[model samples]
Target: MKIGYARVSTGLQNLNLQEDSLKKFGCDKIFTDHISGAKSHRPGLESAIEFVRSGDTIVVWRLDRLGRNMEDLIRIVNQLNERGIAFYSLQENISMDKASSTGQLMFHLFAAFAEFERNLILERSAAGREAARARGRFGGRPEKLSNDDLRLIKTLADSGTPIKSIAERWEVSRTTIYRYLGKLN
Candidate 1:
């Protein structure tokens, strides 16, 4: 079986291109996610990883889509390798099973580069945060829900309104309502 995995960092990014690429590669199963590669709680990717068995192959639109860090990429690849599952990257024309010694070397090189990129990003973000703190401007946006909103959330929740519906009506996420409810109770 040939399974494909595609992911985007956020909902704003389109998945159609990755999906089309996977389909063109003749993938029998495709899992898609709108979560960042840096995140560990990607349900779609986890599901795809768990779905594969021995003799199965996992196809990806690109190597970076699998993980942003080398350790994560290597861990995932090692897991698949342990299960005798091959990995194919459509863009890189990389098939672990078909890779030559040179190709294998290049794969490790790319993983190192990916790890370096992630480290650079983290370093830049930390620098930016430090600069902002020096200026006393390192806080998040003010909450959209005011005290009135919290009261309304509690009122609706107490009246047996579903948190999902209340969130929709209030133009807020269920998480926000739950946070306020947690504080209230």
Candidate 2:
């Protein structure tokens, strides 16, 4: 069975080209996503993965259509190969069926490239975060409560204010109030 997967980065782009090629290749079923490949979670891709079985082939219009990066590509293809599935890319003209020596070599190369790409991304991200920290910036979400708010919350708790009442007043959970009070003491 041939299962086709098509993707477009945005809603503005059309899947017509990929769809036509997959259909021309005589795909039994085609799954599509109108979302960015950068997103790790894709419903169509997941569905296609889940739907396929051993001896099934997943066909894509191009290599990039299937993954956000080379690391992601290797992950997906390796997963399929481990399950006795094959992958076919129309534009690249590559078929990986776990039999051909060329296919095996290509896959090993993909693995190496994926590793290099992953490392480069990590290095860049770490450098960017360090630069941000140097400028008095930080990563992660901003705090829900400020230092002043925490002190006030402590004072309120000390004055015999009910936890539930304080929580209701600040639109925060009772656990939050408890946490602040505990930290203050």
The best candidate in terms of TM-score: 2
lDDT of 1 by residue, 1-185 (tens): 99999999988998999999999889999998998887889899999999999888999999889866677777787678777888889998877742357646755775687688789989999999999999999679977888998887888899999999998997888998898899898
For all candidates, the clash counts are 0, 0
Question: Which tens-of-lDDT digit does each residue in 66-100 have in candidate 2?
Answer: 98888889999999999999999999998987767
- For candidate 2, the 10 contiguous residues with the lowest summed lDDT are 94-103
Error of 2 at 96 (Å): 2.0
Q: Against the unseen true structure, what C-alpha lDDT does each candidate score?
A: 0.85, 0.92
**Scored by Cα lDDT, where does model 2 land?**
0.92
TM-score of 1: 0.56
TM-scores for the candidates: 0.56, 0.69
Off by over 4 Å in 1: 98-185
